[model samples]
Target: MNTIKRNRKNRLSKLAVVALCTAMLAACGSNTTATTSTDSTAAATNTSQTTAASVQTASLDLSNSKVEYDEDDAYSDWNASEATTIKLNGTTATVEGTGAETKDGSVSITAAGTYVVSGKLDDGQIVVNVADEGVVRLILNGAEIHYSTSSPIYVEEAGKLILSLPEGTNNVVSDGTAYELADASTDEPNAAIFSKDDMTINGTGKLTVEGNYNNGIASKDKLKITGGTFEIHAADDAVMGRDLVAVKDGLFVIDAKGHGIKTTNDTEGEEGLIALEGGTYSIESGEDALHSTGGLLVSGGDLHIAAGDDAIHSEIALLISGGMVDITQSNEGLEAGSITIAGGEVHVVSSDDGVNAASGSSDTDGAAGEMPQEGAAPADMPPADMPPADMPQDGTAPADMGQGGGPRGGGMPGGEGSSNNLLTITGGYLSVDAQGDGLDANGGIAMSGGTVVVNGPTMNGNGSLDYDSTFEMTGGVLIAAGSSGMVQAVSDSSTQAGILMTYPQTQQAGTLIHLEDEAGNAIVTFAPSKDYQAVYISSPDMKKDTAYSLYSGGTSNGTETNGLYDGGNYSGGTKVVSFTAASTITWVNESGVTEASSGFGGRGRGGDRQVESTQS
Candidate 1:
């Protein structure tokens, strides 16, 4: 008796009955019914016809078409509590079922076939543990399913599985979080909802995978997110895969306390690859926001990340061919085996170096650029100060550093042998605001085009001449403080000036002083007269406690004379000078050489003035 009941249960669960009353009500009219006997026969025939029309064996939808259910359609029923087992062969088909079952759960299919599941009811997690190796399509028709004990749906050893939901379905809940499977057993580490060998999610439904204590969705092979909204908050990683996790398109929001998305592969050439073609991704993570042991390429997407350590760290190359990436981090913004941003909008705010590629001791690998020699600086062009010909910066010069003018790379701090990392900025709007060296490259910096901005102390020393790095600006606008400026630069117009001074405690009745530019361009070379001889001369480059003598001869305002002589006394005829040193100097309105005396109308003219006047 028990065996018979079990068989009956299985058959009923598979062969579902369509409630004909609902279908007839949908086709109801205001016409009066015929005689009772005829009306009853017509109703029965109508029910049979409706059931036959709805039931069918079809293929899956390979084109990936879909329809949405809004608030107005929320009352409409599109679910099945039971369905007959039908083997799917193609990539397109739709399956309908009644959503009236209480305890037996939904239909169970073990065949290898591709199917699209849709409805408008709330069941528990729809389980699909397939035996054959074929694509299994699971579409939830605006229904909420709660996985109390087992996972909502389980797909085992399937060649491919596609999980989708209605486009307009909203507020679907899974233990306060939507869409995830969890097994509390301590031994099974890789346990979560939707454990499939391989799968694809293409639709408009939003799924929240929140199992921070364990994995969100464990896949033995690969998982690609072509579309949909995935909000994952996990303790380990949001998207976990034993092989590869490719994000071609979707709205992925991962707030992982650990790594945002990770893929670990033990194979040789089949390392995990995370390539982003189009979508929106926002990740906040403790370690690396987006990391893979293999290669990570962001060809096109909008990625905003806030990471505790490094925003993007990968073992291999991280190529940013196209994308809009905004990262705010504490440690480094991007660290990989090699980092190349040929095209993109990359804005990084980091405490350390904005973009760093610290090479590890794995094996002999050819980097994108020449490896920076030991005891040298980073090998990369500093941020270009010159604005790109395509896109210019917002502000103007001095204030904005203008376009194409970025911090020049002098050399990395410490020594050359520290770390041999290379950075190449062939194109893009690169903005880096760092607390450490603005642009420190061990190898070299090459500037072709684009805009790079670096604002900080170049070198660590006095404010005047203590630049930390040496810069070479081959092209582009180069703006740097202290030593961050480009090197050996010769422009069409250049201006340099300094102050000069000398003291004269007493002169031998005649003395002179000359002030000349460093290239012997004498701008101010003057000799004080007898009455004004005992004054002082000042220079801008004078150091404290250093002694200097006044030298003057044969010329004053283009006049030649001898009494203007005497390279003599300390305080007699001239030289009482004082000056200050600073990083930047601005002369408000500088005029030609003008001399003024501290003494009021010869007040300090002592013995000579008195005696000479009386004798005359």
Candidate 2:
């Protein structure tokens, strides 16, 4: 029998455990304190049936949810016969000039009707200051506005504002390095287009915004975009909304030094929210590509993001029902206090955790590599015969756990403290290539249905999957390959069979790992992005007491089998080795030694044990 044991001498004293428990309790009780906790009592009582039921009940239905905006509402109730037309050319304006006024190469509209704006205004501005309840619409037809010391278009006091770019027109708005405020007592508009009231931009034309000072487009209230083409380059946030940011359909190409799309409203009941229904977005950002303080809901879109921080972030909960998201580069791919993915196609290549569920708000300046404090028992600790320190005796997690925790103060992937924060994947197709933990949750992780493939971290300090509380996979196809030092399995509540095996020798990058049934029908196929010594495979396709074989170095020949895309499209490679699985969950070491016959349960915390390394 091949067994891995942890050294017992490394265990903490009982007093230390008790003290840690007390601290965790205090943190959980405090609303402002940031700490996570583990519910060992609940974990102990978790049966496979109950776990599946919990996942089913918590699944989200986002079919009817869509981003809503009123297109004709801007022109509603207004008489087009009484409309005003303004034409500007090189600081000269030609207009009816009734409810409109021009001064110092700037145009100001004070009435509630349609205004057709056209031509060029160099180093000038368009100010909209209507009545307290007026709605004004500006139709741009081949308009180009630029200002050296202020926003090109500034909405100072409008109830509602709409900027419409008609088809076949090309509109441009630009701002310079410094903004000159209309009054020192008033807030300065620091964007190329700044609106203080509810604003919407829609039409079928192309609009470009260049902001050398702050932002490209900023709205203090709700900002909605229905249909248009946008090219934005900004020194700060490209598109910002303080209250709500909603996008129904658009073609957006953004390059920004700060967040690409962001909302900063953190009010209790009205925190900022971002809802994206349909669009094609290509973003390169210095910070998070999509961020919201309140919550974010994505139903459908095609997003390709390269960000310095998290690609998509929400301070509260983030729900993605449908989308095609490819995060080519990010510190963390997706992060939220609680994350729910019902349906989507997501591909993440991250330097840190691929999908992280932690108890922290989005911080624009925070970088990766800051570990969270482990609030729960360490993996090196011995399994407790009694209820764990922070766990109550009732076998229920604390009520506050659902509300989530704060930051772990920096340590490792699984931070200390109790957390009810959750990572729920009801349905999705997720592929991750990570240099850190592939899937990490400070609290609990539940997956009822999904297809997950992880090419995990090469370093032993992290695992393919790390969670502080419990990981329950009632129904899913999960293939994770990485280092063996921190290898973990789904909790006892899983119904599907799993195999955790360590290769006898190092498997080079692009090596084909194939799992097949006794009759040589392919079950799963993978090609890890990095050198790997261990692999974990689980699926509903695996049957109990079924004999299966794991084969390495096989030729796939570009054929798709078993609904799985080939990890490596191999050709003409001889089989290097094979292992026969004899149990529901099999663990094999590097010496080709089988622990299945010996009834090897799972790895627990204790001390270091010697296992042969695949790396020379």
Candidate 3:
């Protein structure tokens, strides 16, 4: 690992359901007394000192989910005789009866539930009728006509629409003067306020719902903005609908060319889910400020997202835990199949593949998407010390090395598609800036705790594995600073020729070194030497005589200056060893090289570094 570049190492480092029956109901509001006492402390973990758990308080009564109105049964409160008040508040009404009373004196709803359309209108044209699965909440009180053929109110049947707008007034009103009503030949005038079902907007006034025929609040099911203050301008997919859209609290503001909030599902295994538990959202998007393939879970919220393509795309699994997320992208700030942080406070800037979890295809068992990459190795196959031209070519060690293909076994390369699509961090407070692949994952990464600080570009210019297609650091306090090549652990294509993994090497003098592998799982870890090369081992695939141990560097009074040429320095004593699967080593350390510093400077070597692999 590059050994501590903390700040700017080039960047890289970055549902469901529903059916619905009646018995449900229960969803109106009020309980957000407001609480922001954050003290994450980077996911503190110190088990084995138990004794804490006792709290209680429970009371529930939601009056059958209240959302039932009846001001006189509606028809703008039955004021016929030519009908024309325009708008009114208090008595709550809006009337403009025309053309045989607009197709025979409408307004006849006999309980099918979900209504909250408050009143007061001027160029009135309110015609809401769902008659069935109910849900329409259009609160536009007096002062918002902006006529051009009228659209003061309209929701025929797409059901579940929420326009809201009166907690403090002025939700949105440009003093009425601009207007457009289409009909020439399918002119598409469906949204000044349109619905497809599933819309949510909390109040405090000034609700601006601009339209060009689609998506300011188009719904299919799942549009939830917890509070108020939303500004939307859409031509398509700006707060769309099909599955999910979320904002737990709000001051949300959006500008879209397309996909400011999208949800689509038809192929690639049906995807659609988005979550942002609290809110203060700002989005400028051309596509994907928050796109969903099925799975996006941000725990708290305070997002400032920008995307020309993908600021936050989710194919499956993106779980941050607590808030304050800032993402900017030309391509991908955060892609997903698996990008997890146990807590929150993330900042990402990307051009492409920043925090990706790739898996649009690659599947072998059921054969799903195709499959071929998960540990890789087949396709050209090389690495066992060469020499098959019938001996004597020079460069030593051939003649069957230790007997046939000698890295592991039976020619390696079996196929049934194993598994890879993980990007796991046990806690959080992460910071990343990437040009590409900062925290990647073809399927691997596990930081048992958190306080992660990755600065970017860990190699991918040819030196191999940039930004993790499989990178691991079992514990926390990881600082992979710029310029590439920090760590890579790839073994299991079946091995071929790679060894020498010093996890903690030492013996005699001052004492210090540790090893494991017998259920304990931690093999070779040596620290104390500064100035580069703290750990570096290559891999072609080495594995042979299982059963290794050296618990502590043996008392070799031999000055130990060859620990792979000085990187392991060695003055007095440092060693603790253990091994079960005796051979097969593929270690690396370059991007902020670990051990001498980066955590674990003393004792059981801080945090998580484990190994107990066995197979003889």
C-alpha lDDT of all candidate models, in order: 0.40, 0.65, 0.42
Error of 2 at 538 (Å): 1.5
lDDT, model 1, position 408:
21
TM-score of 2: 0.77
lDDT of 1 by residue, 347-438 (tens): 76665546654334211212223322221223343222322223222211122221112222212221221122334344555655443434
Model 2 steric clash total: 16
Ten residues in a row with the worst lDDT in model 1? 1-10
TM-score of each: 0.50, 0.77, 0.31
Tens-digit per-residue lDDT, 509-590, candidate 2: 7777777766766677776777776787888888755656666776576555322455444445444334454445555443
> To one decimal, what is the Cα RMSD in angstroms of model 2 from the true structure?
11.1
The most accurate candidate by TM-score is 2
In order of listing, the candidates' clash counts read: 86, 16, 70
Model 2 misplaced stretches (Cα beyond 4 Å): 1-65, 71-82, 182-187, 361-414, 558-584, 590-616
lDDT of model 2 at residue 34? 27
Q: Quick one: ranking by lDDT, best first? A: 2, 3, 1
lDDT of 1 at 42: 18
